[model samples]
Each structure stands twice: as structure tokens, then as C-alpha cells.
Target: MEAVLPVEVEIPSMRVLAESKLKEAEWVKQCYEQLNFIDEKRLTALCHGQCYQQRMARTFNKKGRPREFSPGDLVLRKVLHIAPDSRGKFAYKYDGPFIIQEVFDGEAIILNDMDGNDDALPVNADALKKYYP
Candidate 1:
């Protein structure tokens, strides 16, 4: 029996198909994100018509965040303070009056308002200090 050569598939169409699939993805996922969460009760209710209440997790007081912010919330940026001997060439210390660009459940804040330009500095909820009203 003679061995048959594998069939060559078109690559361009594959790329187009992949792009279409990406565009079809949910809006919440199109943007860069690592993880996402939703109300388990709501999901359960939708699936089984049951109501649920929120409860504190093990790290509630430690890691639990209970705040929210808008796109224009002013926040202070805190970075690691670098002592030449401790951090290296640059001092890794808290810097800035960077205004929060976007807030993710107040658990994370994106800052960049420096000289009127967005800088793409995202920080953990604990790292940023918001200006008190």
C-alpha cells in the first residue's frame, strides 16, 4: 500500500475563523482579566430558584475588601521602597497622586493620571490610599 501525503489546510481562513470567535466572546472577557466572580446565589436561583445570602469568608477581615470607587477617584500610589542596598538602583517607595482610572470592586485600582495622561498603573486595593471625602 502506498503512503498518502497529509492534506494541506488553508491558514488564512483559520485566522479569520479565530478572530470571529474572539469577537463573539463575552464583553466581560474580551478585555485583559485573570479571573471573574458572580453571585453564586443568583446563579443557583437562576438554575434552581433558590435565594442565598452573602457570608464572610475566612480572610474577610484580612483580605476582604468592602469598598468601591469610580473612574476619577484620586488615590495615592504605594510602591516598594527601594533602598540602594535593599531594592537596587531605584528607590521602591510609594509614589504619586495618580488618580484612579478604573476600579475593580475597589479590590483593585488602575491609576495613570499623571500630567493629564493615563499611565496604566494598576495596584491592589490595599496598596492605594483614597482621598477621604
Candidate 2:
């Protein structure tokens, strides 16, 4: 009866236990640092939410609609088809009867396409559209 050793005999070496603890602590520290970094990045708040949506799109485009064009105007060219073999969303937006020719200033314009294509390019009077008839 003098040899009664009844108990869970878990014998972990002191050195091994200490090493394991150190490693675990290091891992935890690294994880914390990583998490902190991620939070900071997010905090940039997606770059101030894209600079507050570009300052609310420059204050709602300053109440838009200032599209001015001259030089033989006959606009109508806003068909930016985002093809997926498009023809959905009620297609036929507008596709030029162009023919501005030149009016660079308040909105730049120099379109031309009634088969009279003379290197047509510069166009931005809000994508043009004022060809009534």
C-alpha cells in the first residue's frame, strides 16, 4: 500500500513547456500586429470613400446642364453600349447625326459623321445631344 500512485501522470518537461509558451506568445503578438495593420488600412476608410465621391461629383456637376456647342451644331451622340451583345435596357440611346465640326471652349466639340468623317474625335459637350429633327 506504500506504492499507491493513482493520478493523471502528465509529465511535460519544464524546458519544453517554456519554449512552447514563448512560441505561442510570439505568434499571438504577430497576429495582433497584423490585425492592427488591417484595421488601419480599412480606417483610411477606402481613401475617405473616394474623397467623398469626388466631393459629391464636384457638387452635383454644379447643377449640370451647361452643355454648349456651336459650329454647325447638330449633336446627338451618347450611345456608350456596354456590350454583352447588348440590345437590352431599351437600347437605341443615341448615336450621332453628329456634325459639330469645331467649337473648342466651353465644352470642346469637333465631331463629324454623316459619312463626312474627317478624323472625328474631340467631343465632350456632355456627350452631346441636341439634334431636334
Candidate 3:
């Protein structure tokens, strides 16, 4: 006489399966959070890039600044930004010496007239050259 045995398989319960699914969902949520952080970093970089171009144009292209001066400094201003029609003789001409009043964020320079009057105007640093008397 011979005896036969039936094959049996075991499977996890519903509770165990649900727990696995929860773990997977948590992992997916963590991945989404990381993606959000990356997106914010990219957005910040783009904003800075756009601003840098305008800043460079005002700073490097205008006067080709070598050195900068601070407030209440006596400096010469070479007016190259003046229109050609303004100066009948020349277009890229340097104006008489001026005194610096205040520097605004490396963009604008408030300075007095050639005679050092009280009236001050904000001009680009490139338009005015520092005068060392």
C-alpha cells in the first residue's frame, strides 16, 4: 500500500498585505517631497540668473568699472552715457570732474555737479568716472 500527500501553499493575511502597501505609500510620499525641494532650488536659480544679466549690463558694459568709490568721496565723472545730440562736438566724451555723494547697491551713484553743488542726481557708476584730485 502507498500513501499520497496533497500539496499545500501558505499566503500572507490581509493585515500583512495592507501594512506592505502602507509602507510603499510612505516611500512614494517621501520621493514627492524630495522632488518638490529640487523644483524650488531650480526656480531660485532661474530667478537669480535673470537678475544677474541686467546687473552685469549695468555694471560691466556701461563704464567698464575698475574701482568703485563710497559716499562723500571726491571723484571725477567722465560722462560717456550722454547722447550724441547732447554734445555737438563728440558722442563718447568725458565730462568735467564730479563728487560722489552716495553709492546705491553698486548700481547707481549719487553725485554732485562739477562745481560740487548741493543738487545731487543718481547716475550709473559707468557714466561717472572717479576723480582723484
Candidate 4:
């Protein structure tokens, strides 16, 4: 009813500023792409180095002894427990010197105690280590 100040604000200047900022951002992005682009020699070297390291690591497994077990072989089973009240850091990393009762296709094995009771569950071969006295 009463005009104290100008009610209509100039909007075209704000739109023009926003469009100029968007164009500037696009130009900056193109400049960054040109500056930071990797050439063919560097790209090929990076990829070849990664692949060679992986292949070397895989082939280096021949240096370590592989885990294989038969029936009647003594082994130590890894016990993964998450007890909050444990005192030391090395509290019960492995449980027992369980005997391998049976081996199934190199995937899993049945374990038993010294008394020949099948009280433990079947464990994967990766979880068993040779129990050397």
C-alpha cells in the first residue's frame, strides 16, 4: 500500500554473473586436464610396474612351505576369539594340537583330540598349521 523502498530488484546482473562463473569453471577444468594428463610412456610404465610386482609376489610363494596334511598328522588350529577382558595381546592365538582325522579334497579336514573323539568341527586347511614339537 505504501512504497518505502524499491520493491523490484535487478535480476539480470545476478544471472549474468552466475553464467560467467560457470564458463570460468569450465575453462579451469580444461586447463587442469591439459596440465595433469599422463603421457603414453608414463602410463605404460605405471601399468607394467604394477603387473610385474603382482606377478613377482605370486611367484614368490614358492619360497615358503605349503600347508598339506594327511590323516594322523598333528596340527595346531588357529583360535579366533574376541574376548574383551583378555589381559595380554597374545592371549590364545591358537588353541590345540589337534590331530587330522580326515582330509577332504584339500579344502577341509576333520579334527579330533588325542583320545580319538570327533568333538571338534571341521576346519579349513588354511587354519591348520603343522604342530612341530
Tell me the alpha-carbon RMSD of every candidate.
19.1, 16.1, 15.0, 13.1
* Backbone clashes (count) for model 4: 0
* lDDT top scorer: 4
Q: Model 4: per-residue lDDT, tens digit, 1-133?
A: 3223332222223344354466777656655664565476589899999999999988897687776799999998887665888767768888688888899995789999877789567788888788987
lDDT of 2 by residue, 3-32 (tens): 322331233333434544667776567557
TM-score of 2: 0.27
| Better-scoring candidate (TM-score), 1 or 2 | 1
Q: lDDT score of model 3?
A: 0.65
**C-alpha positional error of residue 125 in candidate 3 after TM-score superposition, expressed in Å:** 0.7
Query: Candidate 4: minimum summed lDDT over ten consecutive residues — where?
Result: 3-12
What's the residue-level lDDT of 92 in candidate 1?
Answer: 49
**Looking at candidate 3, what is the lDDT of residue 127?**
62
Tell me the spans in candidate 4 whose CA falls farther than 4 Å from its real position. Answer: 1-57
Residue pairs in collision within model 3: 75-131, 76-130, 76-131
**Of 1 and 3, the candidate ranking higher by lDDT:** 3
Report the C-alpha lDDT of model 3 over 102-126, residue by residue, as the tens digit: 7888678877766667544577876
Model 2 alpha-carbon miss at residue 92, Å:
46
Local distance difference test, candidate 4: 0.74
CA displacement after TM-score superposition, residue 112 of candidate 4 (Å): 0.1
lDDT of 4 at 48: 100
Model 2: residue 130 alpha-carbon error in angstroms: 15
Candidate 3 least-lDDT 10 residues:
1-10
Q: How far is candidate 2 from the true structure (C-alpha RMSD, Å)?
A: 16.1
TM match of model 3 to true structure: 0.39
